[model samples]
Target chain A: MSVINDLLGGFATALSLANLMYALIGCVLGTAIGVLPGIGPVAGVALLIPVTLNLEPTSAIIMLAAIFYGTQYGGTITSVLLNTPGESASAITTIDGYAMTKKGRAGAALTIAAYGSFVGGTAATVGLVVAAKPLGSLGLAVGPPEFFSMMVLGLALLVCLAGDSMTKALISGVIGLMIAMVGIDPVEGAPRFTFGNEFLLDGVSFVAVIVGLFGLSEILNTGTERPGKVETPGFRALLPNRTEFRRSNPAVARGTVVGFLLGLIPGMTGSVSALLSYGAEKRFSKYRDELGSGAIEGVAGPESANNAHANGALVPLFTLGIPASPTIAVLMGAFLQQGLTPGPSLFVDHSELAWGIIASLFIGNVILVILNVPLVRVWTSILSIPPAVLTALILVFMVVGSYTINFAAFDVFVMTLFGLVGLGLRKLDIPLAPLVLTLVLGPLMESKLRESLEISQGDFSIFASRPICVVLLLIALVIAATPLLRPRRRKTRSKENQHEAA
Target chain B: MHEQNQAAPPDRPSPPAGPGPTGPPGPAASSALAPLIGQAVLALVAAYVVFTSFGLGLWSHIGPGPGFFPLVLGVAMLLLALSWFVQERRRTATPAAAPAQGAATATEVPEVPVIPGIPSTPAAGTGDGSGGRGHVLAVVGSLIVLGLLIDLLGFQLTMFAFLLFHLKRQNAVRWITAVIISAVGSVGTFVLFGAGLGVQLPAAGIPFLANLGL
Candidate 1:
């Protein structure tokens, strides 16, 4: 009853006219962004941070959160119509989704995806509402030493699962930490790496760096390519048969469970959930044989899982102050920019704002279904716009966005440098997720480590002496040493994977 | 599964695969030089940080000083660079020690995107893997030029040229189309953001241009 009452109060705040309008705008723009060829949710969300700087913190966060989940559904449009994923999470959907389009059931596939997303996203929001207070309570019990160790664990998980090479991922993570190390030190207020530059005083701007890495690099990568062909699914084609909906219902349920569970882990992103869902459908779905042949279950399950993962990711950012994925890491940056610290403190200190943001997510999910299902043709047409035109406009926005950060030419240059760095990293097959995660975590991790040391009177054993800290660090150590310990096992597994593919 | 690449069959024209995640990092041994260059840069950066941290003071009475963490990070980076150098030399020394098993399999299946929104692979395809460098270089060079010229010629003028480069030079659209698109992108955004939204933008650094309302 107390939870329901709190939620009802949240409804009161979220239902205000201005807040609702921001949510709507967020959903609309997010859909367009997801439909864009080169940009994905990370760049899309980061680009909007500068735009949101003018709004109140509550309204800013509400709009950005709406955009985050909205892209999940929007990405489905590209998958079904063009056989291209708007984002990586939707990549698996292209297999069955494009097949459905070939069979003249593109509309049915998209409708099911939207319905699955609405169900999964709404269910996850309910989970968030139910789980927020307790998780936050548990988080409050952790001290600085534990917090420091936990962040290390978070980085380890990120690098371990992020890409092909953990070394490159770790290197990226170190670079991010070094980036954060610029500017005034939190404790002593002495500058560490400013090199006497005024702009470096605040550390490298997060928005500029990401906009460079994600947006600019994307344009440079895909700028010259032509847009692919997409067949528009007419309105009459949208109605899924009774059988189609009924068959997909169970897959949606299973996907929600899988996605929500995986999303709880610090480094597991929505694409991982979507992939596992795809794998699960291959193994456990009743219509497994039809998975790659335009079966509705293939479209519904992974789409649901990805959407569920997007919402479920907010749980950790809210409760434990850890970002679950790269996109969520940018969102966490928004929270920090709003002058609010996430974690247990957010719940206690800003209950109204916290609950309001959660409530608005429910409203946003409803808005996304409406935008994605009946109006999906609008998005397909977006794919028709000349790639040259879109790329040019995006670059313009990128420059303007970076410039507004502090009204400086310096940040724009920083963005350009990172764009080159991003290109180099991408070409090298180094994962960007670890860099993004550590960039968000670096300052906070540093503060906690310093505080823990202060409490221990500068004793290094403070980390090893505390039971929770020791346990967390041990987990991190094991993960970090896996490459050294299990090289033979890794090679064997790859061999097996090759054999299976053959 | 092999299904990853099958979705985009060869018959269809697709977005440039943007240097799809280096599969076996390509066949050329010349590519191995990249790691050496990376190590040299990292080693130099690490050395600078260690040297700078000594001046910043590593310890304070209460706890670690501002430099303490940077010092640690510097040493960590040096260690990782050394490790990479060692690994690469060993692999080069014995080319046949390990077969290209991972590379062979990599071509069969693309890197699964573990993170949503990120491709893990930057470009899905690299169209012809040709003629893209010039356009990319143009963007980089233009951005730097914009940084230098934004204050001189102002936001409107530099943005106009930047957009024009993408539209006219790289993309090779007609002059009218390029002019119109670049105009709308530059002047229109300048008005919406600078005038309407009241976000500050550079007007001009020179007294003459500022007087002319650039």
Candidate 2:
């Protein structure tokens, strides 16, 4: 009842014309970029960072949060309408989504996606309200050692669950940490690896690196493909039949739970959660044969999971001062830039603002369903543009966007360099998400560790002394051990063999 | 070593696939030899990391230094790399190999004949796969040359030349159009960053381009 009343109060603030307009702008811009193939929410949010720099912190955060979910919702249109996937999270959606289009049930797939996103997003937001207070309470007792151990445990989670090659994943993670080390040492204020270059002084601009890696790499990949232009049909009647709805309901429920849980875990964000849910659904679904053949469950599961993951990732950010996803990392950055510390204290200090953002999520999810479902046809038409021309335009936009960050040409060069590096990593089949996540988390982890060490007089035993730290370490050890012992791995191999035999 | 194998395509017939060169160049390398190459690359990277961290003073610090974390990372990498190398060698020593898939497209060479008449794409898409490596090299080479030329000719000229090359190559635009577009792009960038945003553009050796009329 308190949740509802507090939410109603939040709604009054978020419902104001100015705040609502920011949310709308964020939603529309997020949808536009999200519908475009290659660029993900990471790039979309990063590109918007400079623009939001001047806005009030609450409005900026609301807008940024809206964009994050907006991309998750909008990305499904391309996956369904065209064979191309706008985000890696949507790749599973394409398997069934494209199949649906081939079967002339594109309208149904699009409708399910929009509604699934809304349901998952709204559910996760409700979960946030329920979970955050208690989690924040638990976090209040945490100190630097607990925080450091948790981060290490989080990084370990990525090592275990991130796509193949634990060694490569670790290597990439270390590289990210090294990149984070380039700036001044927080403890001593001594320069570490800048090598006297003024550009190195700031230790690689986050905006420059992200824009270059995601935005630029996308352009390069776009340049590689043979563009297939298609025209989109507009304004379809958006309703799922009883049969379609019935089939998807269970998957939607399962995906929401799966995505929410995954989001709660640091390091594995929306993309991983969505993919894992898709895999789980395939393994357990009674309509397994219908999967990858336009099964509504296919669309429902991943779309729901991705949005749920996006909303639920906020739980850790607001409660623990740990960003569970890259999008949240930027939002955390925004919070820090505003001189606000994000932890248990934030809830007590800024209840209205926090609750208002929470309240606005419900409004945002409802708006996304209303706008995205009827407009998916229009969104799908965007893919019809030639990849070459489209990528060129994106490259131009990336340059303009990066330069606009600090209005520096050097930043443009940095974007290009990172783009090439991103392309190189792609060619090697190395997943970039862990690298980005590590880079985002590295400095905070280091600072917390240093703080803990200083507080403990260099006694490392403090890490194990705390109950929370001990539990997280044990969980990490168990996660690290399970893969080596799991019998299901062989079964997976057998399935792969069968797939190859087919 | 086993960890490196995780990056390779599965079903290489070895219990713990050695980190060797990634999958077969074609299909047959899956038996034993391919993983050796992958292991070698991983090993090399591991070695480089160790050397770099050590050279930057990892172990010699009186207390905790900047190199401390990297040293731990390097040792971890080394252990993994060595494990992979040993696994690959052990696999290679075994003799019986699985039947390998022959290059199915050997007789049917996938070729894209360059049309003598058609203008080449300014962009590299739809080109022969050969151009992929070439495109990467070209971009790298372009950057190097721009770095060198910027001091002599200035950013505006270098960027203009670079854009002109792209406009002509990919878009196959008319000379006038290329010139106009390049000029507009360069000047637009200058004004937007320099005047509007208060960014300081690099001054050109050429007098006219240096003066923003500020």
Q: Which has the greatest DockQ?
A: 1
By lDDT, the best candidate is 1
Which digits, one per residue and each the tens of the lDDT, describe model 2 over residues A211-323?
A: 77777665554443543555454445356788998999888998998999888988776766777788778888889888877898999998899889889889998888887
Q: Residue-wise lDDT of candidate 1 within A98-197, one digit each (tens)?
A: 9999999999999999999998888988989989989999899889998888889878887776654566677888888888899999899998889889
lDDT of 2 by residue, B113-185 (tens): 3786343432212233523656565554555565566545655676677667656656546789778777766
iRMSD values, candidates in order: 5.9, 7.3
* Per-residue lDDT of candidate 1, residues B1-214 (tens digit): 0111001111111122213355443434334666677888888998898899998888899999998888998998999889878866765665543333133231134556789755554443243243267867888998999999998899988999889987776555789999998889988888888666567678878888889877
True contacts kept of 1: 0.33
DockQ of 2: 0.12
| Local accuracy by lDDT, each model | 0.81, 0.69
| DockQ (CA atoms), all models | 0.28, 0.12
